[model samples]
Target: MTNEAFQQLLQGGVVLLDGATGTNLQQAGMPIGVCPEQWILENRDVMIDLQRRFVEAGSQILYAPTFTGNRLKLAEYGLDDQLGAINQGLVAISKEAAQGKALVAGDMTMTGQQLYPMGELTFDGLVDVYREQAQALYDAGVDLFIVETMMSLQETRACVLAIKEVCDLPIMATLTFEKDGRTLYGTPPEAAVVVLQNLGVDAVGLNCSTGPADMVETVRKMYEYATIPLIAKPNAGLPELDGDKTVYKTTPEEFAQDGRLLIEAGAHIVGGCCGTTPDHIRALHEAVCRLTPKAPHASHHRVLASERQVVEIKLDGSFQVIGERINPTGKKKLQAELRAGKLDMVRAMAREQERNGASILDVNMGTNGIDEKEMMLKAIYEVTGVSGLPLSIDTSSPDIMEAALRIYPGRALVNSISCETEKRKKLLPVVKKYGAMFIALPVSDNGIPKTLEEKHAVLDELLADAYDHGFSPEDVVVDALVATVGAAPTSALDCMATFSHCKQDLGLATVCGLSNISFGLPDRIYVNATFLGMAIASGLTMAIANPSQDLLMNTAAAANMLMNKEGSDLAYIHRMQYFDKKEAERKRQEEAELLASHGTAGAVETAGESQDAEQGPVNPVYQAVLEGEKAAVVALAQQELAHCMAG
Candidate 1:
């Protein structure tokens, strides 16, 4: 189905989705430990009857019984060789059952293999798997695609990318959150909404982990950030053991009552999950059919997200710092490490900057004697493993940027898209495709604009081009083109004017390389911090800077408080508390190092020992992997294996 058509359907009212596929099929004599898709094809009449009941009972959309039809899952029953036949057969059955009454969505789910750094599956490998299944479903003429019961947000992204690569089918994704309202991988509901919607999912929400009542709060959380439709497909209730069988005790009436609460809590689409039947969907439809669906929250809220956190960028919100320490431009140590294909320094920098309150981490892997794209991907994997902060993919190469965005697994901020011919031609489409927010540098083929008028003109042209590529102002963060004050006396003033114009006149967020204003000057930190305060006053949204500098970070906090930005007072106070705690820890580490420096046998222990002592309890193997200590990992693994074998 076209996205426009699907949206028009939602505009009519609440979109009712069909209830439980696996659970209902099991009740229809589908045996356990057998391939569900294969069984459905063998007993097509039973499957058709069940779905037809849902359609008659008021399900506007029916999920085809292709949930586990992906190649990997079918391989468990040795049906992988017939993957195409199984998926096509299942879609055909659902289409037959629909009989023009409802639309058939090609259902998808997790591959049962975890993504890299957790299990063996690589991101590209998983995408290829979903691509094969999605192609089969598309060939079978499924109207749309729905990826449900996803535990990993990364895996969901793979599925959406796969489907989009195959066709422009309307895709909806839902995660199964734990009772505490986070996925098994620690992604919260709001993060899921922000990340998936930004990745171009037609609808994003929760399904299967809990009953309708317990899902209300998470639905509300997702609603606050959602710019697309929200879906709630909760179970009948918490499953219970009844003798030898699993049962859901909530009656259809109770399920229907909670379904109304879900609609009220901002779910535009409502459905049933485990233990829900046609009767339950009928009750739910009766309960919520008349109520007006809640409209999705309006877009243009500038936000970036990692897998676990969402960072909102506002024109007047707290000043955000995109940590700049991960770049290997002038850092000789980092450059050497990158050349050796080691990401230990990169991982350390990411963790340190996050601890220092960086809102985003800027990752730039450009260096001599190293493959930039290869190192960039490696850096992304390492940083995401250690930090929950969203990353700024800083690269001058469009090819590298596309490679990074394809597998980065979160909503990244493209370090820039300028009006330069090569950049506009190559980068804009990929940025839009990945749903990334980008730093719009107002430099064209003629180079830096000499005047504020010229700069604004460049920005206007770039924005017009972005619009042509289907981007909104919310997706564009204007770079105010920071020129050195040492070169132009009025450079800082011009930049502040650009910031004010972008914020007040154009209604867009702004960012800058914070230290560029003070280049070729003495005590650059003071100049940098002072300029940052002024920029924040003039409506700067975020800046790429070294967040480890207390002066710059404190000035940002103080500026936010002075501007009376919401929650800045508490934020400043909390920052002070964190500083105090950090200072105490630093002093304790110093004393421990001093004591260890003078060993009892006059052989000074290394600083690593002192730090390890202060940190308490170490998993050496895990630490070795985290630090990218390849030799240490090999030695440690061999030692552990030898011990296991000897025992």
Candidate 2:
């Protein structure tokens, strides 16, 4: 037990976690659409009184009413700068209320920025925000951190990783899943356990979900593989509208009846989530006391995840693309625009890559005579906030890496680390601290490895360094030293050998700069696509390239289908649909131009046709209303409502 008192309680039987903070606060006159933390600070007595009731009701773990007190969420109230003060204030009040009775946890949650592939938040950014709040809570003194009601597995990962970095407090991570046992974002029970348990959280469970009964199977799934204690804090059987207020459907007795299912399923902690009262907690406390934890089972250990989904990288699984267009590496126009303080192009490129099926976007803002750190952070924010895809934080500077890594909302893939001692000393700790995945470019004091023997030796050194810094092979993606054919004709052949060796022999995932194969060549996209197909055939799991190229994307999609990629054909089909429309539009433009060859008369007629297409048909409802047909309009509106209801 990271917190001694809480651990002792766990040893006896089921440790009791508290009921809903929001619902209880609302019952005490805290309104919706206002910051709960701020309201609690203003009405301290209400919160303290509510907590006292929970303690009396037998809750041993009380989460502080600091759910959305992080800087990003607080920024909505112009309170971002007061994050520390707000968190400190929360811990102080909760501690005072606990008063040597129930232990208080520093409650943290998401920034409402949905993590990448779902919404704009980055892993590093989420980690930074949570660390800021955790530090404050620890400073003001709290027993542990409870990141609850988390809707995304990746955001939950960020929160736990962040807390582990800032404090040694026992961390409990609970996610909000739907009745189907997966989160709304579709992270099933065991997938979440794989990620959370590997991160070494004290307890993993479901909270703020449908009800205790609905969570039993989910708890069972987790129990099957969870070696640590499991938690089950569910809603009081969903909410219903009680006139203007929300009400819990499950009564105290009924809710407690559901707890037996979770307990039977091997839950070590049982409590309530939304709409649960102290009465509910009291019943649960009594019921949970009679249940005992069951033996745990073993499971697959490696998990690399995004905010909304998990990426289970088996020995031979699906290939992934990390789009390279977000970087301003060799593009003069983008470089000029970025230096001029613009991100429109970066956003456009991000969307384009996402459209072309890039699993992640590689972002590099390094340019001469510019604040690389500032630009990288902005680019990360723009790409992530808008495109909402995972990113590779591409930078050589340690400061730039740390800055971008801190604020990125999803788990980021670092572009590199080498055998340079200073680089290792500075970069490896940051990666380990944040728990971000990384790409290993094995450069030793002897320079870039030229042979399999040299590359293997360099890889061995990097692996040793990584382990020394608390990283695992599952956390690494080895960069295929794909050398340019112009520099060395056999470079391409040697690259293939390295990629095959890494994926097949060494059991490591491999990434390559795809366009490097066609450098200094004409029709590069076609060449790159061909090389990409060969690479994919050779077991290259990842590639950093321009996903916007039709040929390259087509080739990649084809390879996935050829390799029997499950469901990848859907993306390929969508691409075909897009290309069909594109071809149609191209033909239309050509036809229109040919028609306009008769000069101004044809062009004018074409313009008129375009205008007619835009106008479409007139609305009968608007016409009737304009003609003073009130009764007809009323009939139309009522009919529309009826149709909508029927539909």
Q: Which candidate's lDDT is highest?
A: 1
Clash count for each candidate, listed in order shown: 1, 8
**Worst window of 10 by summed lDDT in candidate 2:** 298-307
Residue-wise C-alpha lDDT for candidate 1, range 1-647, written one tens digit per residue? 78889988998899999999888888889888887888888899999999999999999999999999999999998889998988998999999999999999999999899888778899999999999999999999999999999999999999999999999999999999997779999899988998899888999898997899999999999999988989999998999999988888789999999899999999999999999999999999999999998888777468888899889998778889999999999999999999888888888899889889899999999889999998999889888888899999999999999999999878999999999988899999999898899999999999999999999999999999999999999999999989899999999999999999999999999999999999999999999988999899999999999999988998999899999999999999998898887888788667666766666332234545655678876777887787565557989988878888999
Give model 2 RMSD, 1 decimal: 8.7
Mind giving the per-residue lDDT tens digits that candidate 2 earns over 1-647?
25676667778887888888888888789888988888999999998888888889998878888889888999999888998899889888887777878888989887888765346665666778888988888887888888888887767878887888887889888888776667876677776775576566878888886888888888888786586788899899988898987788899999998888888898888888899999999998777676776745533433454443445455476677888887777899998998789877887788778777788888888788678887887777666545556678999999889877766645668899888778888999897755577898988877888787788788888888998887776778888778777777887777788788887777788888888877887877777887888888888888897776767777887888888877777867877787676577677677677767856566757765775597664556785554434346888878778888999
Q: After superposition, how far is residue 503 of candidate 2 from its true place, in Å?
A: 2.5
Model 2 alpha-carbon drift over 4 Å, by segment: 1-14, 20-58, 64-102, 108-141, 149-166, 173-206, 213-231, 240-246, 260-268, 285-314, 522-526, 568-575, 586-647
Per-candidate TM equals 0.94, 0.74
What TM value does model 2 have? Answer: 0.74
